[model samples]
Target: MGFWHTMVEVFPRFMPVLLEGAVIAVEVAAGALVVALAGGLVLALATLAPLRPVRFAARAYIEIIRGTPALTQLFIIYFGLADIGLGLPPLAAAIVGLGGNGAAYLAEVYRAGIAAIHRGQREAALSLGLVPTDVMRYVILPQATRIMVPPFCNFAIQLLLATSLVSAVAAPEIMFRARNLVMETYLSPHVYLLAAMLYLAVSIPMSHLTARLEQRLKRSR
Candidate 1:
């Protein structure tokens, strides 16, 4: 009863400020997604390169990024880089760090999707005089996109939630604003609960969309 009373008192005051932060969170997620998609695609192609050294380097990057904690990566981008005069703004650092981390994961997703397409399709494309790039662009990726869509959506949701980590770097996303509110109001429980709700508001829809995509994919299969 006491908690409910406090929540009622805080709700109106807290919501508007938190919504402003949510906008920034969405922006960060979108920026990071763009970076992840581009980097992941490049890394995926590199991993599949004919040269052993190229494949080895790409795999090493994927492994190293995947092996480290994301917070450390953010710190490196936001703080560590500053020591060498390569400081990025908090928002940029957040996007780059998260996107870089996400790329390693998404590269595997891209590889799996590409591999799921039959080798016969690639051979047929080649037999039609298509170069490797066109074979990938016209034949392989068109089919692989379907296989990748659901996982991509899933990863987007994960990335959205992971934006909370950026608060450590003072990027002023949802959790960062929530922490500030808690500090000012000394209402940790109420503020943090509202923050969680804000994240859910975005994440729930994304999760639903991912589920729908998976269902559609299964039906098509």
Candidate 2:
């Protein structure tokens, strides 16, 4: 009864602030995803580029990003850039940090997806008199898209969770607000409890979508 009362009393204090924070988190995740998708596609293409330098550059970026911690990357994007006077706002930093980190992994996903398309498909498309662009547009990409969906969904879910790290750089996301509340009230349990619920609320749907896609992939296989 006492625990319930404390929870009820603390709810009003944390819920509103956390709700606002949750919205910011979602916005950051979604915006970062746009960056990842576009940049990842470009990086994947670079891997197949005819020039050795292009391939080397793309490989370097992927390896460096994938090799380092996401939080370290966030600090680089947020603080390191600031030291150079190219200071990005918190939201923008979150986008670039999360997006840049995610792009490395997504690039691998894109590369694998594109590669999974049998070389025969490309050859057949060329034999059909389709130009390279048309071969990619009409044949290769369409097939790769199907193969990519499950893994894409998985990475997106992971990226959504990664948004929590942005709060450390003062992005006003859910964890940021929760941390503030904990400090102010010193009621750690109630505050963190609510934060967990809030994160779970957002994450549950993403988890579901990823699972469904995986199941679909299996059945197709």
Candidate 3:
């Protein structure tokens, strides 16, 4: 049969399976984002810490993580961590691996957003007798957070796509599920096409949301 003929027959049959996989991917992304956002905040703060060593360590971490391929990091977490007596479950490993990778990029996003605010804003808050931490919490962060949102959502979308890499660790995400279905059904064209569409089903809506959010923030400013 021609490719289109086979796809017509197989696509509908695999749609549900592909969607189930996509759901898992979403879960992985959500879990990872919790880690990413928390860790990104710490890293962003470290970059501005009073201590020199703290800033160096944070910059080093961001550099090393951002420089490396995420797949390699995933392998280390999923496989290598066992060497240190820390054996993470596949799904847990996928979350940590993806989250760690995301934290570095998200740190940059937070950093840029925070830095974009005028220095005088921070100084003015300090003049009010606010401690450094209180200044960040009340003054800088409030405005900076608004700037961070659209970019953070964009990163979340990227993180969702990145979960496809979890298939390498057999994490049962969308790509992994689709690959198994393709092997079992021998419907590569249909399964893969459906898988791509499942991803688009996420990314397209998010892309529109990103644009709309950017417009809204611009107006609010």
Best by TM-score: 1
TM-score of each: 0.97, 0.94, 0.96
Against the correct fold, how does model 3 do in TM-score? 0.96
Cα error of candidate 1 at position 216, Å: 2.0
Over 4 Å off in model 3, which ranges? none
Candidate 2 lDDT, 68-162, residue by residue in tens: 99999999989999999999999999999999888888999999999999999999989989998889878988889888988888878778788
lDDT of 2: 0.90
| Better by lDDT, candidate 3 or 1 | 1
Model 2 shows how many backbone clashes? 0
Clashing pairs in 1: none
How do the residues 21-99 of candidate 1 rate in per-residue lDDT, one tens digit apiece?
A: 9999999999999999999999999999999999999999999999999999999999999999999999999999999
> On a 0 to 100 scale, what is the lDDT of residue 188 in model 2?
88
**Candidate number with the higher TM-score (2 or 3):** 3
Best of the two (1, 3) by TM-score: 1
What C-alpha lDDT do the candidate models reach, one value each?
0.95, 0.90, 0.91
The Cα error of candidate 3 at residue 60, in Å, is: 1.2
TM-score computed on alpha carbons, candidate 2: 0.94
